[model samples]
Target: MTSHRRPSSPRLGLAALACGAGLALGGCHAERIVADSYPTTVAQRHPIVLAEGSTRLDLPVGAGAQGLTSRQKEDVRAFAADWRKNGRGPIGMMAPAGAFGATAVRSALASAGVPATQIVSQRYTPAGPEEIGLVKLGYVKLKAQVSHACGLWPDDLGSGGGDLYGATENREYWNFGCANQQNLAAQVADPEDIARPRAEAPIYAARRQTIIEKHREGGDTTTGYRQADAVVSDVAKE
Candidate 1:
């Protein structure tokens, strides 16, 4: 995580920080220099944030449909696909009472790999007449999530407030760049990737054998990149 910088304001006739001295203000704004120099809390620099948490796929239960609507059915199917790939453990079903489209949910669940014999059920209450109910498919898979709302200002910036002493010192006030961390966490599609690298893909034996055979027949091993699909990067090799 990186700290965001606010624009630096001149000291207004005060000493202008030296051009390149270690003690001088860097290219960072004036507030950044102070915030970096003296922070009131560790959270200002390195905050502990949740990388993963419990999340649910909420599917709307429509009323009088007597089952999932076409859109809802497609949604269930999509959830099923994801669950099969990344779900951590057993899938639990949360069914509202008299839920519509019970059969469709069951069918979709079965299609996704849940056995009919092992299907679990629960009672739920419907919120409206047009609504049949909702079926929840949950698994405690390797999900990475973040805490809700962090990096709030620790000290008040008002004049004559209890934290007035904070102003005299070059200390970073609370609530700096908390939203940036939260935003970064939200961009993570898989929390596991944040903590560790992904697993390597399996080799294609058939393709490897073909290449080996071609090499044995005195063919050129080097192949040109596909111009249409090639991805070029300038990153230095480790």
Candidate 2:
């Protein structure tokens, strides 16, 4: 009657146990998650144009009103000249919209060896809701997508998308206002008014790279770029 019970089931090693558990969990496999990012470097460069400062121009701030002093007029002319020479064509007029437009203009003038002067303040009514809405949509649709395409996620603080609603709204508002100014300037005078001395003024395209780079360094560059790129790529893919 020396019957020994069958040896207890062999104990599984940690590895074997893990494998069994994994199998039991429906054999899930790790899949690469793409947040659809954009190029941070390019996005950042877009706003760099403002870093240069304001350029003094010799032009009058008003139309035959003579509101500006002689010195002020000279400063305006100097700035206008430099803007015509080095600024990005008609687009340069949009400088007032950007954060560093004044600074960049000053820097450009100085670089061109022009003297500096005080700038006259020209205030206008705020943008209407329709304009504001369009701008907001542009940011939400374009810039935000760009950020996300660069492999960025709203949750990632490094991506700078944490407060995307606010940032995008602000950017859109500013850009819209700037664009509106350009439109008004264009309408105020003939083509000559916005004309530049140089045949080839700078273009916004050059700043594209700068925008992307700055954004990359400032946040989750990889994610933002990836997300943005993916979004665009998908549209193209479709």
Candidate 3:
């Protein structure tokens, strides 16, 4: 008996090609998903976190000292000014039991425009003889800071590690841009400025009026300044 070979099915060949193409596309898609799992942007990796925090000041008082000295009073005043600007709750003043500087702290805080109701006094037992006259002042306030701590190296920078392929991908390392984020957080004056925009400041009425008057009279709207030697010396000419 003579046997004939079965002809190859065109449909089976097309189906094999289709499955191979599908596998290739699926591999690329899986790689994209894996790459996106890590934070790509600096802000995403090290975000500026707004949270509640406290500010503290420590003042050392001698056993024989009377009230706060002039310098201490100034320091307390500056601290209170900062509290008034950003602090939320009462300003707390803590001292060793039987310490003599509580009255002085209250007086300085009052002089700095802090109301008596806004100041809270507490006393603590001294840890040692050296802490007898130490007075501490603190208040709760809103703070802006980086979420991640600086100086952390989670990955290797060399070519012989697990991150060797990652280095070739031209992406930022884990700790890149952390210092810039930290500095930016430290420079933020108001945490609210990061969350929302401030209200517009009042316009300079006098300057606006002057400019409008000059425009109405067909005069130069641009400001002219009369320079004087007393105001600005012409160092180049001299």
State the lDDT of candidate 3 residue by residue for 119-237, as single tens digits: 88888877677655778899999988888698787777764474654666777788889999889888999988877889999999999999999999999999779986553456655
Q: Candidate 2's residue-wise lDDT over 192-236, tens digit each?
A: 333333367777885677778879788533434334335776788
Model 2 worst lDDT run, 10 consecutive residues: 135-144
For model 1, give the 10-residue run with minimal summed lDDT.
Answer: 28-37
Better of 1 and 2 by lDDT: 1
- lDDT, candidate 2, at 125: 30
TM-scores for every predicted model: 0.52, 0.20, 0.75
**TM-score winner, 2 or 3:** 3
lDDT of each: 0.61, 0.38, 0.82
Best by TM-score: 3
Per lDDT, the best of the predicted structures is 3
If candidate 2 were superposed on the true structure by all CA atoms, what would the RMSD be?
Answer: 25.3
